[model samples]
Target: LSMPKGYAMLGRGILTIEGVLTFCSPQLNFVQMLEDHAFGAMIKDFDALKEFRQIGNRLLGALSKSMDIPSEIADVLKMTVRGQTKINLGITEAAEPLNAVNKMVDKLVIGIIDAALLISSSLICTTDMSPKIFEIPVLGMMGYFAALVVGIWLLNGIIRKK
Candidate 1:
């Protein structure tokens, strides 16, 4: 496809995705919290969306290659392609807000841990301890940060699991 045509297609896809995200934003959080069985159903829906995208892409490619195709026929084909593309785009757009929410939740969890660390550090400082034992607080802080990183990684894995 020509660059202009491809960009136009992308623009339409983005707009459609934006509309879908707006429409579904309210329910996104609830959907994320679903049990594994229900989440499997959601994954099926995502797979269907991916299939629609693939079909749309194939239709567009086929239409582009057939020079002898009538304009009327081409128009119909383009419409179908764009429609399917929009559905796929919408699904992708809907996922963005959910990702943002997950990041926010992860940050909140980390913040709570930080608060606890601060409280514990203050309590530890009040005690008279050997210099060697003082190393424990520094190590504890390092371990807590390491745990934060690992926890976020695991959470992302859980979220992305099929």
Candidate 2:
């Protein structure tokens, strides 16, 4: 027996799903790459700073034990180390807000991708003649709107850079 036209429709639906993923893949990749690079750099810097602090503390301890350094001088050095430790704590505290911002960005990007998938699936599922014609304009309008928003965001970033 021959297959019905619905079989072809099923194939088209699969293609649409693939296209949606293809469209969003680059954006997801870019976000992941940027996040990885940023986290890598931050971790590298934090580790370097931590190692330096440890080395300095060891050196100071050695000096206090071996040299005839006065107690008052040692006390001042201890206070300095305490202050630096507090500063490092403050940096960590400040990072909480940055982490929140990163989470928000992740949610926003996921929302955009979900919206795109929803729109594409809706377009694919509409089998009627009239609605399918109407959907094309709506889809085009949405595409234009998204492009406009992205352009504005890019412009804002460029302006802020200068």
Candidate 3:
């Protein structure tokens, strides 16, 4: 998909290259938008700082559970071993694989974006949809429920040996 300026979508075909998670590098404009908008910045800043600590905890949890990778990574080898376990385990298990897992550093990053995208698109499609519906005051957060279902499926797949 070509953009109005010059940017284009990265690829079309399902990538067969194992361990090379094939997400298109997130466009710079997305970060630019986050930086430019006050609400966006505040939302991202607050959420990311919160998620950052949670991510550290999760990483430690994963490291403790890993067998093949050394938990105590040396400084030099740190970058090399950083994601070896997740990619190996994640792609084989996670439903969306590359886009949903590896490229996303924090769970909240994907969660927030996925929810935002869903709400935004839903709003666009149904202009009459109250913002409350996205917030799910009446429908009781079906979006959140859907996300929970997907998240459960992903975690269940990862935690279980197939």
Candidate 4:
């Protein structure tokens, strides 16, 4: 059969595995998107569950204490009633080292300045003002050069630090 317009030669047959996989590849992206959405919802649910467990522990402990039980025994009784378990609050990832943080902040600031210079230079180049270098404004050219220098400096710093 002739390949349909806009269909690649390898993707023209419904019966071929390659054709089916090629057609289905776009749908595979939706799976990742759905997984991400589901994971975020799961995290919210976990946080709510953690909060619920904490409230339950507090309420149970208060009730047990009000019954005139000794504080130590009330604690034990609370544990037993709650299935003798520990509730983990949440996962904690180790923080970046201070040096890394500082370096990131520095790079971020420099990157912003570089982007600004690039945008401003592009705008300046579009203006009718003269003192042109190859028909481009010299001021804009200077800005572009400055941005290139900043970019190189940023890269140099990153490489040296590593």
Residue-pair clashes per candidate: 0, 0, 0, 0
Give lDDT tens digits, candidate 4, residues 1-162. Answer: 876665774344423654455587844554455569989998877877779999999999999887776777888889989899577785456355766788799899999999999999999999988999899999999999999999999999889978
lDDT of 3 by residue, 12-84 (tens): 2212221133344433344344347977667666876678999999998987778545644553377566754
Single out the weakest 10-residue window by summed lDDT for candidate 1.
26-35
Q: What is the TM-score of each candidate against the true structure?
A: 0.26, 0.23, 0.20, 0.42
Name the regions of candidate 4 deviating beyond 4 angstroms: 1-61, 64-96
Flag regions of model 1 displaced more than 4 Å.
1-93, 132-162
lDDT of 2 by residue, 1-162 (tens): 777999989778766766676697744454455569989988877877778999999999998887765876787789887884334334557778998788668657856765675566456445343433445545554555665666567556557756
- Colliding residue pairs in candidate 2: none
Predicted model with the maximum TM-score: 4
Clashes of 4: 0
lDDT of predicted model 1 = 0.67
Candidate maximizing lDDT? 4
> Which 10-residue span in candidate 4 carries the lowest summed lDDT?
10-19
Could you list the CA RMSD of all candidates, in the order they appear?
25.0, 29.5, 30.9, 20.9
Q: Candidate 3 clashing pairs?
A: none
How much lDDT does each candidate structure score? 0.67, 0.66, 0.55, 0.82
Candidate 3 regions with alpha-carbon error over 4 angstroms: 1-136
- State how far residue 43 of model 2 sits from its true place (Å): 45
| Residue 24 lDDT, candidate 3, scale 0-100 | 40
